[model samples]
Target: MKSPEHPSAGRADVRIVAASPDAARQVADALRRRFAATEQRSYPVDDSGGTRLHLTVDTTHRPEPAQPWLVSSRSSGDARTQTDEI
Candidate 1:
């Protein structure tokens, strides 16, 4: 696996459209360590739609692989994870 860089360097790209608090926090912690940056923000329940987090992080400095963190096809967007685990 590759090492994470600081957000200031823009090394990764991550987004969480809807995830449970526990999952989100776990992912967030992993992300913080992986990307070496604090979270962007926490959403309020009203805006979150539920007890899920809707967060986005931009780390575009890293090299692009065969697949990326997100994929878009005109009317929709999807995520196809490249790693076996976060």
Candidate 2:
């Protein structure tokens, strides 16, 4: 699949699914430290039973390269969305 062309293009995108917002934040922090550059966003769902966090990272300095690394590093159970250009 093609990678998104956002500023974070060649970077790695991380998504965390947690039981609570706090958990998601905690995971995001951990991921942020691991990755040099990171972007974070949150979403609200009617079903508050649990919280989910999605993070996208730009591993490469290039505007848009390949996303093989992302596909490989991504969690087996997590849902992913790849866009073509921001």
Candidate 3:
């Protein structure tokens, strides 16, 4: 969803509309991990299958970077737990 410029600095309202509930949730989850997000509200688009999720995120805030090993593990599709690395 394109965010029109907000009057306030470092904060934007975002709306995530997806064809399915799962798809909307995945986008919301990823956004939450990356930004300081408010509680999400979900709404049904119509009688058909579609979802709309609304939330505000603080653009100025950023989540910590993933650890090197964890990042590499994901890229390689290795399911080893952190303890398994020991």
Report, for all candidates in order, the number of backbone clashes: 1, 9, 0
Model 2, residue 35: C-alpha shift (Å) = 0.7
lDDT of each: 0.51, 0.66, 0.87
Cα lDDT of model 2 by residue, 1-86, tens digit: 99855544566656677888888898887655555545667775458667766777656543333468878687877555657634
Residue-level lDDT of model 1, residues 1-86, one tens digit each, is: 98865444544455554445566677776665434443555554555554444344555432233344455334344566658857
Ranking by TM-score: 3, 2, 1
Evaluation by lDDT, superior candidate among 1 and 2 = 2
Candidate 2: 10-residue stretch with minimal lDDT:
57-66
Instruction: List model 3 lDDT by residue over 31-82, tens digit each.
Output: 9889988899999999888999998988998867668886666656666678
* Best by the lDDT measure: 3
The CA lDDT at 52 in model 3 is 96
Which stretches of candidate 1 lie above 4 Å from their native place? 1-13, 44-86
The global Cα lDDT (0 to 1) of model 1 is 0.51
